[model samples]
Target: MAEFTFSTEQQELRKAVRRFAADNFDEETVRRLMESDPRFDPKVWARLGAELGVLGLAVPESAGGVGGTLVDQAVAVEELGAALACGPLFGTVYLAIPALVAASAGAARDELLPELIEGRKTAAFAVADQAGAFDPAAVTLTATDGDVTVSGTVARVVDADAADVILVAANGSGGVGLYAVDAAAAQRTNLVTLDLTRPQADLEFASAPAQLIAGPDEAERVITHALQVGSVLLAVEQVGASQHLLDIAVEYAKTRLQFGRPIGSFQAVKHRLADLLVDVEHARSTAYHAVWALTDGSDDPALAASIAQATCSAAFSRVARDAIQTLGGIGFTWEHQAHLYFKRATTDAALLGSAEQHRDRVAKLVLDTAAVERVPEVAVGSPR
Candidate 1:
């Protein structure tokens, strides 16, 4: 097992992010901000990036960003997830940044990265087409390049309206290529998504002029790696959310009275809270392992990432549902923040890929390989 520890700088970053969350993500503030158009305040995002530099945590120093690592980015994202933050952080930083980083070096990479680092522009990666699986086979969108144009509809694109540019995965003559399109050129229709805090949009492109980021040869590899990065970070985000839910549920159990005594005194309520603790801790372990794998470039980061997503998604969803149950009627109520957390839990589970999807991937990677590796040779003459 690998050792786990945090640096002093990372600890300070945690404190700063916690303070930011407390001030900006208090229940009332989150509700107010999410209710607004765009679902996130640009000024607040600017402050988060240009001031704290959290958005630039994993960006290269040459891009005028904080010279930091993916673990730093994961730490910040985990904090934001605990707060149930409503912003462009997931779309811009987690998804789009990795896509840009994985693409071949070009003018678009040079210009756009600095813009995102400075909070001057927000970007979203087009994960899948209408079919909804984020693989090369699902990349049905086509691009023709007399002048490099993309056409097709991508459904459920995260933060589509909030983005200034979109990194589109489309089939081109060279093969599957990654193209960049200005948001202004594409038509966006807002979706009535489950999580209001994280809005999504359906985008329609009709020969929208685009800039090629990754050629056919590299596009598949680039998108696969970026999604792995997103899966790991999102697992950590689930951990943060699960821990918060567990804390609140425990507090409620301790104080909420039933049958002339605190509910926590009873065995059933105690068992429920205890189970949540186990789930939260398990989620933390898996999430952190994936982060380590990603930062260190482990032998099989994809397997680690898929396992983390599978474990954390189920854990967080259960934590949210049971926390709501622990709270009884209040958990089901609209005014309570428990439902908000539940919404985030369910949405995150299905956002990039569901728990079922990742579990299938995990089984394929582990079981298929084990079956092949376990084959033993028999002595032809000695055995009967």
Candidate 2:
């Protein structure tokens, strides 16, 4: 594949988003939103959809979207992460929309896509089981006679309470499939999580009426594709946050004084900051590669996504940890914003799949492909 670099337009879009976040997502605003119910500001969310066209970045124009690519979505998400903005955008754009697009053509896609693209409706994916596994077999919800019921609790559902619509993975007579459930039909309990900025909820469904999007034959494929897209896009968000933390650390090092000299002049601090910069750059490159692979559909997207997820998650965690260390005592206090970024980094590392899981996936894909390549070729009618 060709080299990956953001286009001039994409670059401009990133700058615009960064400026918007700086103006709107200040520290006080973020803190207040974290403490508030729903954990996201409706007015800010609406403004983002209307002014920046963020809600439709990857949706097709026919579906009332901007007709943009996955790369565009990644660009926007990166800026959101950098600003530490909290909202339902991640669940809506990264998870729900992708699931919708991957499903078979039907009213679910036709009716909901426009609403989602126009930001008239919000959606969440109920794929994670109580153990937080994304496996279809892990889903305990049952579907019968076109009515899906989820008796067991779905833990760590991102933005469930805020969603108007929910795409649930359930076991039906046809097999595993995607079902659309109205949020009102389900019982939702907001849960206090490590990262309060990105809130999660527990959902219990008792015979909740639903519309099937994709049946057993195609449900697994659709859910897997959605997850892959989400992982790749989430890596971009990690890169943005990692880069921001690094910048903050470096800036603080330059101003923080000790022994009548700036802390940045100390070799130990300089080395730490330099290492973090390198890691951030590495994460950026990996995330961009995955974005490009998904956008062009020219490479092994699964492998690219796994690599991005593993590398970016670990890198972001390390950057956040070192950023706190670099900031000294103030970084540890509850008031410092470094803790927020650190908490987000740690929580997000395990949100979709942990770093270890993605790394194992990478190893399996590489070894499996190699095993296939190494198999001996049989001469015509010789072995038999």
Candidate 3:
């Protein structure tokens, strides 16, 4: 993989996003979020939607999206990650956007994509089950064609209650399929989650009418592609959280005095911080490769996605744990923000198969390729 340097335009956008995040997403505001029911601040979400035009970044320009590639979405996600912005931007912009684009057509794409871009319509991608697995084949929700409806229940759906459109993965006799379910058409039940910053809900499709956006076999492919998008964007977010953890650690090391010297100046603390920098930088390289591969519409997108997911998952865990350690006693307290980053990393990592799972996938790819390239041995070395 080559070193990634953002384009001049991307760099400028990064600066803009940074400024926007700094101005809006402060510690106090995040603290207030802990008290809210939905966890996300709608005002902040609308600002990102209207002012930043984030939801449209990955959607086609024709459909009212920014007409940018997945790489562009990764850039925006990095900024949001840095701020630890508590919103459904990740769910809408990165996860749901691509799935909808792949599955919907005609009026669906033309109508909904634009609304999603403008933040007029909130959307969520429903794939994961209660077990934390994102495999669409494991989807127990059945969409049966009845007199007036297709009905089923989807559990552990992210941002389902708040969304207007849901891209659902359903299984039937035909196999896996994708359906665009109107949230209003189904009975939505709100649910509590460990991560308050991101709300979740259960979607009960009690004979609800739905449009079949994708065929049965295509559903898994679409879901996998969406998960790929989610994995890379989540990597960008992990980068943000990791970068912030580094910042917190550095600040604490410099300001906090121990034994008449700054803790940051201590060799042990310095080395640990250096190690963190290496992890974050390496994760950045893998993430950039994944994003580039995905946006380029290359043949090896899945391999790249696995690499990014594997690398970033480990990087996030390292940065979060080290951030807490560097803060010593204060880090363990709920008053500090270290726990927030820690929780976010864990939540994001657990969403799309853990680091180990992705690593195994990458390993399997390598093994399969090697097996295909192997040649039969000659008997007693008598023949070539």
Candidate 4:
């Protein structure tokens, strides 16, 4: 409803999160975590739940949460991405929780939301098809007589190994629906991803016992809405990462000397950094608009989300690349932190949907809306 500018309270929240991240997720800490299997500290996750109230930021108060808005969640995620915070927080907050909230009110929401909000349980949404599409019709899991089974492997299942429960999309006799499956019931193998900070897994389900959360009529709409939410929040994360990379590049240019002069003084370096600054600011605006659309129940959330994804995804990737170039050879070294952001940018650009896919979505929406608008004119011009 309101403009995208952050309120005083929101600014304070962002500042607090940035401070927390600086203390806990420094470069040394990130490097150490990457060397570990889980790639995230349980203590840090616990602190996020206990101190930051991040787990429940988007959940409703009736569901045992803090009753925060999507914008609030976006603010938190932006800071987390800037800090390169590693954990299952994104999958839980952006995907799993949203799916539960979108489902028809039932035992699933009642029993699961509380645990999720309290961070006692973590969940991942297993909706992406083999080819990485998030379409409900793309779901390969089958269900019959209240039992759901998935045989084929689902790829890029974020945080699957760490999740206690998985909210799976499946097609049943009743049609498409959301199903809850315990992690132990499914076989999981961690996949080696370019971004080690955010691990993924391939899950195999064989006749896994599952409870239906929403039936065919509501399944597609619910899943699509959840995805839009994820996309918007993910765009916010990209903006944060882009801003951080820009900051790193500019600082390096100022300090690093070339031929007895600061590299920042060079016209080439200044132009590159200036271009990156414009892109990052544009991406931030797009992400914020999408967040506002979601929070305010705008008529065209799909359009808003697709635009944000299409714009921010490419913007972040480009910024990351340019940042690395600005820093010279050191940016390419594994020991340097620039590579981490580059990997994250590449991975995140393909996380939910690629930039090309989102651009297609935007094109379709615009054309469809234009067609609808033309119908009125066509009818008025015709003899009646």
TM-score of each: 0.93, 0.93, 0.89, 0.92
Mind giving the per-residue lDDT tens digits that candidate 4 earns over 1-384?
Answer: 445578887888899899989999999999899779667887787778767887778777776777787888899999998989887866788777877776667976789887876767788888873212356657877875565554455777988877889888877887777788888988999888898888888898888888877788887766776777888888999999999999999999999999999999999999999999999999998998888767765436677888898889999999999999999999999889989999999998887788898888778778755343322101001111
Per-residue lDDT of 1-384 in model 3, one digit per residue for the tens?
555578887888888888988887887787677567666767677777788887667766666667776777788889888878877765687677766666546555566666777777778877664222256656756777732245677776777767888877776567777777788887888887666666778888877776666677566656666667777778888887788889899999999999999998989999999999999999988887778767765425557777888899899998999989999999999889898888888877877778888888788767766444333211111112
Model 1 stretches with alpha carbons more than 4 Å out:
129-134, 370-384
lDDT values for all models: 0.82, 0.82, 0.74, 0.80
Residue pairs with backbone atoms closer than 3 Å in model 4 (clashes): none
lDDT of 2 by residue, 245-282 (tens): 99999999999999999999999999999999999999
Where in model 2 is the C-alpha error above 4 Å? 129-134, 147-152, 369-384
Model 3 misses residue 299 by how many Å? 5.7
Off by over 4 Å in 4: 129-134, 148-152, 369-384
Descending-lDDT candidate ranking: 2, 1, 4, 3
Worst 10 residues of 4 by lDDT: 375-384
Between candidates 3 and 4, the one scoring higher on TM-score is 4
RMSD of each: 6.8, 5.8, 6.9, 5.4
- Give the per-residue lDDT of model 1 (tens digit) for 1-384: 658898999999999999999988888888987788978878888888888888878766765568788889889999999999888877788778877766667997778877887778898888672211256788858997653999999888888977999999888887888888999999999888788899889999999999988888777767766777788888999999899988999998889998889999999999988988988899888888777766765536667777888899999999999999999999999999999999999998887678888788778778876443232211110111
